[model samples]
Target: MKKILLVALAFATVQFSSAQVETPQPSPASKMEQKVGLTDVTVNYSRPGVKGRTIFGDLVPYGKVWRTGANKNTTISFSDDVMIGGKELKAGEYALFTKPNAGSWDIYFYTDTNNWGAPRKWDDAKVALTTTAKVEKLPFNVETFMILITNIKTNGASLEFVWENVMVEVPFTVPTDKKAVANIEKVMAGPSANDYFDSATFYYDNGKDINKAKMWIEKAVELSDKPRFWYIHTQALIYKKAGDKKAAKKAAERSLALAKEAKYDAYIKKNEDLLKTL
Candidate 1:
C-alpha cells in the first residue's frame, strides 16, 4: 500500500508539472483587416509597450533594419495588387521591416514572411518593394505600438504607424477605376433579355404606357430562344391593360402551357387567375 501510494503521488506531481497554463503575453499578437477600394489588406503583428523607454533612437536604433513589431515578424497581406510609394506591389503576403531615421523611414516589403526577427542577413533579392516615408513627431506620447489605416478614399488610403512620440504615413492606391470603367462600358453597350423583361414588368406595374410595355416585352420574348412562362404572363398582363382581349387571352394560354410544362404550380395558378379575369 505504501509503495502504491508513493507511485501515485509521483504520477500526480508529473501530471501537475506537465499541465499547460495560459497567461498574458508581454507583447500580445494583434491583427488588423481593412478594405481599400477593391483590395483587402490584412496585418498581423505583436504590440510591444514603450515601458518608459526611448523608442526611436535608443531601443530601436536608427540607420538599421528593425522588425516592425515584436516577437514573430510583422506581416502584411494584400488581396489585390496595390500601388504604394509610387511602386506596384503584387497581391501576396510580405514581411514588413523598417529602418528609421530622424527625418525619414525606409520601409521594406520582403517576400520572406517566416523570419523570427529582422532578417539576420539582408537579401536584396527577397525584397518585393522599398519605399521611404517622412516621420513626424506627435504632441503626446503613445504607450504601445499601433498601426492604423486612415484617410480612406474611394481608391486609396494612408497606412500610418505610431509608436512612442513619432508617426509615419505611407500612401497606397488600388486600381479600381479600370474595372469600374469596364463595367460602365459593358452596361452602356446593351441591355440583357432579363433587363428588358424587368423594364417591361416595372412599366406595366407602374401603369405606364401600355404600348411601350408591349414593345419591351416583345423585345424580351424575341431575345429569349424559349421565353419563360413569366415573360408570357407579363405580355398577357400588358395586352389586357391595353384593352386587347383577344391578344390577352392568347398570351395567357401560352403562359399556361409553358407553366404546366415547367411544373411551376404558382405560375400555373397565376395564369388561371389571369384567364378568369379575362
Candidate 2:
C-alpha cells in the first residue's frame, strides 16, 4: 500500500506538468464573409492594436508595400469576377498589399497569398489589379486596424480601410446584373425535355395519374429538337397505361424504328414487346 501511494503521486505530478495553458494572441486572426448581390466576398486577416503609436508613414512607413495586416498575408476572395478602377480582376483569392502615401494610396491584389507578410521579392506580373484610393483624415483616432465593406449597392460595394486617424476607400463592381439576367432567362425558359421526361417516368413508375404522365411524355417528345428512341418507348408505356391503345401502338412503332436506326437492341426489344401487347 505504501509503494502504490508513492507511484500514484508520481503519475499525478507528471500529468500536471504536461498540461497546457491557453493564452490570447497579440494580433488575433479574423475572418469575414459577405455577399454583394450574387457574388461571395471573403476576407481573412489579423488585427493589431495601435497601442498609442503612429501607424502610417512611421512604424508602417510610407511609399513601400505593406502586408495590409499583421502576421500572414491578408487575403480577400471573390466568387465572381469584379471590376476595380475600371479594370477587371478575375475571380480568385488574392493577397492584399498597399503602398501608402500622404495623399493617395496604391492598392494591389496579388495572385500569390502564401507569405508571412508581403512577398520578399515583389513581382509586378503577380499583381492582378492595382487601384488608387484617396486618403481622408478622420476627426478621431481609431485604436485598431480594420477593412470595412461599405456603400453596398446592387451592382457594387466599397472597401474602406481605417487605422489611426486616416481612412481610404476603393470601390469595386460585381457582375450582379449579368448573373441576375441569366438566372431570370433560365427560369423563364420553362421545363426542359429531360425535365418533362423525368416527371413522366416518375409518375408512371410510382403509379400516379396516367393521364398526366401521357401528357408530359408527349410534351417531352415535342420539346426535344430530335426525340430519342428511349423517350418514345417511355411514351408508349405511359399511353398504354392510360388505356389509349391506338396512341400506344403508334408510339411503339415509331420507337421501334428509331431504336433500329440508333442500333439500340435493348430498346428495340422493349418497343417490339410493347407494340405486341398493344
Candidate 3:
C-alpha cells in the first residue's frame, strides 16, 4: 500500500508541475487614430477581438447600435459639406453609430454632440443610413477595427471601413466649384494684398495668367512703400508682356538691386536668372 501511494504521489506532482509551465499571453491592444480636414476625414479604429466565434450579436450584441469603441463616440467633424452613404450632411461634426445585424449593418449619424453610450434619447432625429454587406467564404476575425477616408478631392470622397470578413464603403459628393470657392472665401481670413502680390510673382514664373498676375502684383506694390522684390519681378514680367525689352531690362535691374539690399539670396538668384533670359 505504501509503494502504490508513493508512485501515485510522484505522478500527481509531475502532472501539477507540467500544468504550471507558463504560457504566454497576447500583448495589449493598439490605439485608434483619425484625422479630419476641410475636404476629408480619416478614421483608424483598432480591431477589437471578435475571437473565433461568429461576431455580430453574439460577441457584440445585436439590435443595439454600439458606440463603435470605448472612447468618445466614433465622431467625424467636418468643416465643409460631405456625403456619406448617399446622404448629404452639411458641414458639421457628427457621431457615427452602427446597428449590427445577422446579414447587414445600418450606419447612423447623430448630430447630437453628446456621446456616452447609445443615446436613444435622440432616436427620431438620428440620420439612419443602410449599406449592404458581401459574404466572405472564409472566416477571419478583426482584432482592431480600422476605417479610412481616402481619394479625397474638392467635391467627392470615399470612406473605407475594413475589418474581419468585411469592408464597408460609402461614397460622397460635395457641391460644385462655385460653392467650394465661396466656402474658401468665407473660411479663409487670408493674407493681405502684399501677399497677393507675392503670389502673383510666383504664379508668373510658373506660367500662370500673366495679365491677372501683373494686376495683383501691381496692387501689392501700390500697397507697400518698400518695393518688394517679388512685385518688382512681376513688374518686369508686365514690361516683357507688353513687348518692351528695354523696360523689362530696367525692371529686372531694379529687382536685382532690391533683392541684394534685402539680402534675399534665393530671390536674388531667381531674378538674376530671369534677367539672363530677358
Candidate 4:
C-alpha cells in the first residue's frame, strides 16, 4: 500500500510538472470584424509591439515578404466579392502578406492561409492580389500594430495598417449597388417562373390551399417560354390534387413528352406514375 501511494504521488507530481500554465503571449492574438458596405470583413492576426526596436527597413527588413504580423500568418476574410484597385477578389479567406519599403508597402492577398508567420515556399500564383500602398510617416509612433477600416462608405472602405511611425492603407470596393439594384429589379419585375413553381410546390407539399397552388402552377407553366419537364410534372400533381382531372391529364402528357426529349429518366418515370394514378 505504501509503494502504491508513493507511485501515485510520483505520477501526480509528473502530471503537475508537465501541465502547461496559462500566460500572456508576447504578441497577443486579436480578431476584428467590420462591415464594408454589404460585405462582412474580418481580420484575425497577432499584434506584436515595437518594444522600442526599429521597425520597417530594419527589424522587419525591407523588400522581403513578411508574415505581416507575428505568430500565425495574418488572415482576412470577406463575405462578398470585392474589388481592390479595380481588381476583383472572390469572397473567401486570404493570408495577408506584405513587403515593406521606405516609401511604399507591397500588400499581398494570398490564397493560402494555413501557415506559421511566412510560408516555407512562396508561390507567385497563390497571390490573389499585389497592390502597393503608399506609406505615410506619422509624427508620433504607434506602439502596437493596428489595422482599421478607415474611410468607410456605402460601397467601399480603406484597410489601414499602423505600426511604428508609419501608416499604409489599401482601398477596396464592395458591390453593394450592383447587388442592391439587381435585387430591386428582380422584385420590381415580378416573381419568376421558377419562383411560382417553387411556391406552388411548397403549398402543395405543405397541404396548403390546393386551388391557390393550381393557380400558381398554371402561371408558372404559362410564364415559361419552354416549360421544363420537372415544372410540368409538379403542375400535373398540383392540378390533380386540386381535383382538375382534365388539366392534370394534359399536363402529365406534356411533361412526359418534354421529359423524354430532355432524356430526364426521373421526370419521365414520375410523369408516367402520376398519369397512371390520374
Clashes of each: 0, 0, 7, 0
Each candidate structure's TM-score, on Cα atoms with residue i matched to residue i, is 0.65, 0.74, 0.47, 0.84
Residue 108 in candidate 2 has what lDDT?
A: 97
- Order the numbered candidates by TM-score, best leading: 4, 2, 1, 3
Worst 10 residues of 2 by lDDT: 269-278
- Which residue runs of candidate 4 sit more than 4 Å off their true CA positions? 1-20, 224-226, 257-269
Candidate 1, residue 164: how far the Cα is off, in Å: 0.8
The digit string of per-residue lDDT tens for model 2 on 1-278 reads 99999999999999999999989988889898889989999999998889988899898989999999899989999999999999999999999999999999999999999989989999999999999999999999999889889999999999988999999999999999999999899889988899999999999999999888988999999999996989999998998889889988999999999999999999989998887798
Evaluated against the true structure, the overall lDDT of model 2 is 0.93
> Which candidate would rank higher by TM-score, 3 or 4?
4
Q: Which ten residues in a row have the lowest lDDT in candidate 1?
A: 174-183
Q: What lDDT is reached at residue 149 by model 1?
A: 93
Q: Model 3, stretches more than 4 Å misplaced?
A: 1-38, 42-47, 120-122, 126-139, 150-154, 176-278
lDDT of 1 by residue, 151-226 (tens): 9898999989999999999999987787678788979978878888999999999988878899999889888978
Instruction: Say which prediction, candidate 1 or candidate 4, comes out ahead on TM-score.
Output: 4
| Cand. 4 Cα-lDDT | 0.93
TM-score of 3: 0.47
State the lDDT of candidate 4 residue by residue for 1-278, as single tens digits: 99999999999999999999999999999999998778899999999999999999899999999998899999999999999978889999999999999999999999999999999999999999889989999999999998888999999999999999999989999999988899999999999998899999999999999988988988898899887888888988988988888999999999999999999999889999999998
Distance (Å) between predicted and true CA of 64, model 1? 0.8
User: What are the runs in model 2 whose C-alpha is more than 4 Å off?
Assistant: 1-19, 201-205, 210-278
lDDT of each: 0.93, 0.93, 0.66, 0.93
